[model samples]
Target: MSGTERGGGSTVDAVRAWRGLAETSVLLDGFHALKHALRFGARVPVALTSDKAAVLALAEDLAPDVTRPLETLLAETDEATLRALVPRLHPTSVAALAVRPSRAAQLETLARLPRTAPVVVLDEPRNLGNAGAVIRLAAGFGATGVVTTGTLDPWHPTVVRGGAGLHFATAVERVDADRLPPGPLFALDAEGEDIRALKLPDDAVLAFGSERSGLSEGLRARAEHLVSLPMRPQVSSYNLATSVGMTLFHWASTSGRPPGTGA
Candidate 1:
């Protein structure tokens, strides 16, 4: 019998649950993805692995803290079974499903005032990978959220795959340009003021134009400050993800770090 139909509703129970929830749930693709998601408090309903010993070894080597919980959660199944469940198997050979946060909860978090970190705004972003990379950066830098003002779903499966399941670490959502959170809007533009001269505020909305065509007229009009990164004379613009990394690093250097963190 298939692992999905064996035992006293053992792994089969969990596997069946995963199958039922897969369409609506968030897929945690690999070992690292599952690890990060669990660490960040994602509500994972089920996890399956081909080799529990190997995954546990990985846990022991990299994340000793989660080993006990993983022991209770990981359901051991054969390779064929795992391959049948997940479309493309991860190199580490592990997969899981977690609950996606509600739009209402994300909206509420984004709208809350007295914000400590900046909210990253991707104005009409076209690339899914770029948006995912931006979300990963935002999470690493402790940005309040990563908001996209465009048709691209920031939480698409491809983007989620690119993000390595770090979406649970921060707020990510899509909304119209006019509905962005309350903060000082600092939009990045080629003709704007030099970024080095100013100290970005804690509650700033650090906005970046899309990969192509730059910001829309409506978004540009909403910008309180137009900031520019230092680029050579001939260069037109940096890659969208690279630009966000540079800008976020600047924010971390100025406000996110402790007074003597590196020293």
Candidate 2:
């Protein structure tokens, strides 16, 4: 089960049903969530849990002024009504609640952003867990945004589950390659040029290959360059999410920018 962080402490006064994403978010990565929530300077308005002790502890950790007690936590139970509440809280602090369709389309809307910005595009990867993990890592690495082409769905349950609370913190767009902003595109490939040797631009699209098949022909043709991770002969390549994270980290390190500072 998972849940989102809903804004408005006043909303907490009334015991409205909370969606699962928020409930599960509390458990996704305790240390990471706590750190991110604090890093972004978020006030945890409610800590709804079945157990009183856990609520108290979370309140103490997050800040006593904002914590709201609830009768139950949504993640532990499979209640349909509670689950349905997710879409209703669209654009709320709970990042996973409902993604605006306009926001979804903007991922490929080139006019809104610069061509050289650090963008991540995943193509038909098919695995929500990988996508969600990539979202978290993308935020950690200071990506300007995330865009998915083909059939990859960012709102899929598994991906949302993997993202924890990270989905709320960053801009994620889903679109096709044609919709992507104009720029120097680089696809991650095992046989491509060494990433370490390439003169990576401060702003460019880093297209991660599909988890199973690597880059699609459409993406391959669209990319201006191909990059590869360094590895011993035994290991063919890195995990889809791992490769994206490592590449983003390398870009950040070489650019002399701190992690998570989006250009």
Best by lDDT: 1
Q: Could you tell me which 10 consecutive residues in candidate 2 have the lowest summed lDDT?
A: 88-97
User: What's the residue-level lDDT of 20 in candidate 2?
Assistant: 33
Tens digit per residue, CA lDDT, model 2, 38-125: 3343344333222335534555576554343222221222223323443332211122123223563445443355533477889778
Model 1 C-alpha lDDT per residue in residues 1-263, reported as the tens digit of each score:
11122223378887788789899988889888888887888888788999989999999999987787688788888899899999699989999888889999998888877877788999999999898889888888888888998799998887888888889988999998899998899999999999999899878998898888898988888899999999999999999989998998888888847421321
lDDT of 1 at 155: 88
Model 1 score (lDDT): 0.85
Which candidate has the highest TM-score of all?
1
Query: Relative to the unseen true structure, what is the C-alpha lDDT of residue 186 in candidate 1, on a scale of 0 to 100?
Result: 97
Question: When superposed on Cα atoms, how far off is each prediction in RMSD?
Answer: 4.3, 6.9
lDDT of 1 at 101: 91
* C-alpha RMSD in Å of predicted model 2 compared with the true structure: 6.9
Evaluate model 2: give its TM-score. Answer: 0.70
TM-scores of all predicted structures = 0.93, 0.70
